[model samples]
Target: MSVFSDIFFGGLFQGSLYAMMAVGLALVWTTIGVFNFSHGVFMMLGAYFAWQLVAFGLPVVIAFPLAVIVMAGAGWILQASVVRPLIGRPNIVLVVVITTLAAGSLIENGALTVWGPRSKQLPSLIEGNTTIAGVGVSLHQIAIIVITPLILAALWSFLNRTRLGLALRAVAQNEDASQLVGLNVTALYGLAFAIAASLAGLAGIFMGGYRFMNPSMGADPLLKALIVVVFGGISSISGPIFAAYLIGFFEAASNYYFGLYWTPALLFLVLIATLMVRPEGIFASRSRGLA
Candidate 1:
């Protein structure tokens, strides 16, 4: 019973974090029709930035916002300078992808030089563990579990209520149409990139605190986010969250029965099997032309 409880809550917490990490990527993918391969790089940057701030004597709370701001600014600047100009090129999607990939490599190498190969541990927001359903859990995990829904709710409201978020969505639906209505599509794309980068960075902050920071840490999160995005449906905001929980449940089950060594293989298998059934994703309303 205790082991089952552990798996349940553990999977839930882990899935929620996966959703959080994937949310930013979903935004950019749905809006711009391009996946920022370097999404994980920004997450890595956020963790490192926060670590540095804490080392410099800032309180953890203060360090978080500063790191988010710095990363968000960088995201916005990169979109403006590097990505914006390639908007109309032939095979722009491929070009942007390669650019972001290159950027990611550069960022990773830079982090290696600056932070070295040694991984850094982040101080937890709240010390100690608490009991849940007869199992002990870290406060960070519990916080992640609780915080994810709130974040999702806030995101839902932002996209549905705020003028800016609506504008971004409109641009996503029809860039030319949005421009026809006098919306600045380029500006909307930049804003989308900034928001996506900010969310990824914020996720990184919690992740670093829960685990340890390393230059290569972003790759796993990025891959998971891609899977969740595809599984959930690019067109629906709720898709990533739902898919994340489902994957989390499956992962927990695999961990309990199959052991750690088998988890990765199982995840890939699940990805492949699901893609075979619904390449457009479970949440997509219509086929994305996979057939």
Candidate 2:
């Protein structure tokens, strides 16, 4: 029973991280109509930024915000420079592939040039551990579990209640109509990219606390984010959050009962089964074509 509880809660914690990581990817897709393959690289950059700040004797609080701000600025620049130039091109697939390759090469080369190819650790924002219902867990993990939902709630409120949020939603619903109504589509895209980058930066900070940071760490999270987005349905924000927990639980359980190597196999099997069962995704409201 204790083992089950540990797995359950631990899964929830990990799921929250995955959800945070994937939300940015989903936002860019839903709002900007672009599949940003570079989202994970932004996360990598955030972690590196935070690590560098800590190395320079900055506190975690300051480092965190600095990382976010830097990444947000980077997002703005990427949009203005790279993405902006590709606007109105029919070959979106080419653009996505090119951006992805560029992100990967840039991160790899940048890390090698600047920080070298060494993995580094960051100080945990929350220290110590606590026992909950007979299960011992790290307080940092607990903090992640707590913080993820609060961020999500805040995001929900931002999108639902704020004027810019409503405008973003309007753009997502009908870009042509939004433009007709005098919305700056280009500015909206930039905002979407900024928000997406911010979310990724948050995930990077959380990840840095949970584990070590390296240049290549983004690859796994990037793959997981993509899977979560697909599993949750491309159009529904709620779907990714829910599916992230599901995937997390499955991964934890698989790691516990079977070998760690089997976890990926199990995840793939479950993903395949899920697609077979619900082609549009569990929480997907409409077909992909309609979305």
Candidate 3:
């Protein structure tokens, strides 16, 4: 029972973090109409940015927002300068895949040059741990468990209650129609990318507390985000959110029971099974049918 409680609660917190990362990817897909292979790069950069800011004498509160804003700006630039140009070209999906892969590589190499190959972790926001149902959990973990839903709620409010959010939804539903209605489709795409990047940045900042930051850090989250997003539903926010936590719990439980090495294989198995059974995802789409 003790072991069960440990894995359950530990995975709960960890999976909430994963959900945050996945949510960013899902947002980009739903809005920008492309799977961002470079999403993880944004996360990596965010963590590094925060560290750099602190090294330069900024407080955590200030550093965090600055890092997020920087990442968001990069996302905006990526969409505006790089992605937008190729979006209408032939074999757009393939082009985007190549471009983003290349971009990720560049970002990784740049980080290696700037921060070196050694891994680094951000300072913990809180010290010590708390017992939950007799299971010990760190303050950082508890913060994650508490904060994810709040962020999601805030996002929902923004999306449902704001004009820009409505414009974004309009563009996502039908780009042509939105443009025909005199909407600035380009700006919407950039804004979506910015929001997505900010989410990734926020996840990165939180993750820095638990894990070491490396140039290749984003690689894992990118894969995880893809898995959750695809498994949850492509066109809806809610499905991926649910899928992230489910996958997170499964991963933690599997790691505990099957050992660390087998966890990857187990995750792949789950992904394959989900793909076989529900290729369209476990959740319904916001439109005609679940994407």
Candidate 4:
């Protein structure tokens, strides 16, 4: 029972975090039709930004939100400076994958130079532990579990209920048509990046509180998120969220039964099998436009 509890709660916690990270990756893919390889670095940067703010004696409440805001700006700058200029180029998707990979490396090095390869952690939003169904769990873990759904809900509302969201969706559906309709495609592109970055930033804060963080910490989460995005489906938000939880449970079980070192290999094997079965993703939406 204790072991079961651990796996259950552990998978739930991991699922929530993966959902947070993978959704942002899916958003960028759906919006711009390309992956932002630097996204994991964006998560790392967000954590550092919060850590720096807290180091200066700010409260977690202030630091966390400020970190998210800073990440939004960073995302916008990334799109405007690097991605936007490459628009309309032949084979833009291939170009973007290369450029963003380079950009991710540059940002990771920058974090290493500034943070000096040391691991850092954030103060927990709620410190202490509580028992659930005869199992001990950190309150912080419960908080992450509770808060993630809220964040995703708010994001869903923002993307589905607002005028700006409608415009963004329009751009995602057809950039040329959106431009023809006076939707300001370039600005929407930046907005997409901004939103994706902010989500990644929030995910970073969650991870920082969950475990120690380092410059390269984002790499693992990034890889996992990519797998989730690919396995879940890149065409819509729901796909990644569903995939996150499934993979989360699978990972927890694998870690328990197989050990940590073998988990990644198992995941890749599952991914390979999944791809062999469904190349378009398991939950990939038939109807698109970020829906």
Q: Please report the candidate that would top lDDT against the real structure.
A: 4
Residue 255 lDDT in model 3?
86
lDDT of each: 0.86, 0.83, 0.84, 0.91
Question: What's the lDDT for candidate 4?
Answer: 0.91
Worst 10 residues of 1 by lDDT: 282-291
What's the residue-level lDDT of 20 in candidate 3?
Answer: 81
Number of the candidate with higher lDDT, 1 or 3: 1
Deviating ranges (above 4 Å) for candidate 2: 287-291
- Candidate 3, 1-291: lDDT as tens digits: 888888888678767877888887877777767888899998898899999998899998888889989988988988886689987776777888889889889988999998999989987777688887888788988887888899987887777799888888888888899999999998989998898888888888888888999888888888988888888987878888888888888888888889989998888887888778877787854356333
lDDT of 4 at 52: 96
For model 4, give the 10-residue run with minimal summed lDDT. Answer: 282-291
lDDT of residue 152 for candidate 4:
90
Model 2 C-alpha lDDT per residue in residues 1-291, reported as the tens digit of each score: 899998999799879988998888888888867788888888888888889888899988888898888888888787777777787789975786687669657876787689987778777779998899789988888888998999998888888999998898888888999999999988988888888888887888888887888887787888888888888887867888888888888788888999799888878787888888977777788654543
lDDT of 4 by residue, 170-224 (tens): 8877888999988988888999999999999999998899799999888988999
User: How many Å off is the CA of 206 in candidate 3?
Assistant: 1.0
Q: Give the candidate number with the greatest TM-score.
A: 4
Q: What C-alpha lDDT, on a 0 to 100 scale, does residue 243 get in candidate 1? A: 90
Per-residue CA lDDT of model 1 for 110-134, tens digit only, reads 9999999998988886788989789
Error of 4 at 188 (Å): 0.6
